[model samples]
Target: MMRAFFNRIFGAKEPEPLPIAFGSIPGMLDEREAAARAMLKEQTRDPEQNIRNGIAQLQLIVNAIAGSEHDPEIHPKLKSIAKNTLPQYIRAMNTAMAKELPNDSEEFYPAAVECVKNCLNSIRGPGRYLQIVFPDEMKASRKGIDTIGREINAITVALGAYRKEMAALSDARSRYAAIISCSEDLAKAAEKNQRSRLRIDEMTGRLKEIGQEMAAMPSDPGMAQFTEMKSSLHQLTVQLEEKTRTYAALSMTASHVLRKAEKIATKQKHNDEIAFLKHAMALLSDHELPSCTELNTALAAACPVVERMIGADEIVLKNKEERAVFAETGRFCIDMVQICSDLHAQEDTCRIAHEALDAHPIHQKTGSLEREKVQLEAMLKKERQSQTELTEWQQKTQERIPVLRDELKNKMEGIIGRTVQYSDVFPESA
Candidate 1:
């Protein structure tokens, strides 16, 4: 009595919510579906048999219509019209009912509804004329239809709620599946983020070590020896350059005269000497250094052809540079051959010095460190960019998860008709 008095004064307390584990949502949906299906089976058990009996009643009505005799007082025109149309109506209704009914409720409901429609249509169609012919039989068929309709109405009402619950369960299951997939994706992203951070830290540490080593490298004793070797190589290179210019000036002057000789030789048909002059010019103009001994041999044979051509006055020297190099043929040949030998010797010396310096330990270590640092910096940048992208994706997915969770909660609540409180909380990280 005290409780009743208090209840009258205040609204009833809200019912306690059902507790659901987040991970068990799929299982819950399966259990709910099975329970709903069982409920449907219980409701429809008697209805199904009633529908079968109702179909049997319809079949008897059709057969009775086929054999029903017209009353003596009936109009001849009405009897004739019914006689013509009754067979078609009976055939159509039987065909509608004759179809094999599905065994499952989802399938059976529609089939039963269709059978009901066919039964009603048969009575409402041209079978209306049977009222006068077989009034008693027509009355019994309508009462049978009424029996089937009541059962159908009951099934319809149960199925409406059943279908709504199943639909909500289906929606909840789909939303839950999406949430699971997103969670897995988030876990994978977090794992990759962990690896990326480790790699970035590793690369940054290596870069720092390289910087420290490179900063202290200038004071190392081996650097002095490396510098000394570098200085020696530089001096050799400068001398080689100067010697190369001197050799080029001499070769150009000699080539200028040789060209004139070759043209004359072509006209004079001196094939042997033309070959010699062209081969010598090739040695001089070649981008790669020609063999110095081979060049000396070629020039030894080729310069005299230009000398004889000058002696015959068939070719004239064009400039003072050409005259100075080619006027005294014996002196010019001797000078050119000596300078070619000197150039070859200097090139060999410079090449050996360069190789020796490059092979030094300090030079190799410094170059290796520089290359590694560049590679590490590039890798670090790439990792950092991936970190940013992973963070952005995590943020968006974090926001989306809650929306999906709430939606799932609402859908599950609709399915069960009870507030659901999730037991398992989402993890902060993997």
Candidate 2:
């Protein structure tokens, strides 16, 4: 009957023990083997089925005690069990129930405990009151189980949202890291470009100085000065070439940095840093390496003209000072010449007076006047010789002035890089 009851409750699919092979033994004691098989079957009890049997027995005992409530001591014992033992049993069951539920499962007992406590408080007079409150306690337990289910579902949903938020935050942090690294690279690149620009400026200044010196050289290349100027120019050209190569490399690097910056700008659209990078890149592109090359090349091409101008300026300055001195000397010579002519006339007068005095020496005593005329004659000869030397010097200088002027005009034309024309030499003069 017990076996039939277990089969009916637990079903045919429940595990069964293997039958004992009593026939395989040669000289088996049938009675002893049957006893051993029975003992083995009795020892192998199913825990769930046993628990069900125990619960059924407890229900039967409670029902029997309730039916025999005329007994006085049984009611107190049942009350003690309700107050302590049942709660402990529920706790043990909850521990077992946790194995089936999630780790973060909600509390199942509070609502049930509260409900039972409230129901028990309402029924205070007698021990039989629990029997009356049992239905309400069961209802509260069911409600508490529903609350646990709902709370578990809610917690599961919230955890999902939290995970998603964490993922988004991680993505944002990654982008920030990329931006920081990219920005640092750009800063280094910009600094490199700035250094290159400074080098280019220094080299350009040196080239310009060389060009100016070359311009100031004599137009004749065979001159010792021109030879030295050409040597200096060669050195400057070498330096400029090196600087140009360095500038080209820097420009390539700048271009690379700009490309990266553009990508960053797209990635971080609406960012202020990207806007600044764009502006700086535009400025770099507009005013950089190629402009330097163009300016230097232009300066080099115009060097010859500048040289001719420099030579012409020197000639004009030197000739101008020379012409002024010649004019003053010529004026002094003219005055001396006039004085010499007057002296010659006085000398003639002195000679004639002397001859006259020789004739009238005896008649008229003019010895002091004759001595004065001899001194005047000697002074007149010296004055005429000095005037003649001054006149020759003045004439030579006056003759060279036109040659100097022509040379100045030729030099000026060379500077103009055209035929000799007044307008060409000085456009403003024209």
What lDDT does candidate 2 reach at residue 253? Answer: 43
- Tens-place lDDT per residue, model 2, 1-430, is 9888988998766334332221211122334334434543333223223323433443343344334323244466665655654444344433333232112212222332343343233223232334432544434433443444444344445444444444444443343344334445445545655564565455455545545544544453444643454455556556555554544443444334444545544675736545544553443354433233342333233222223333455212234433332234334224333443443454455555545444542312234434544555555455555545545654554454445445544433332234542222211101
Best by TM-score: 1
lDDT of 1 by residue, 285-394 (tens): 77666776888789889988988988888988878998898878778767777887887899899999999888998899899999999999998998899899999999
Number of backbone-clashing residue pairs for each candidate, in the order shown: 0, 0
List the global CA lDDT of all models: 0.85, 0.41
Tell me each candidate's TM-score: 0.76, 0.19
Worst 10 residues of 2 by lDDT: 421-430
Candidate 2 ranges beyond 4 A from true positions: 1-76, 85-135, 192-430
Let me know the TM-score candidate 1 reaches against the reference structure: 0.76
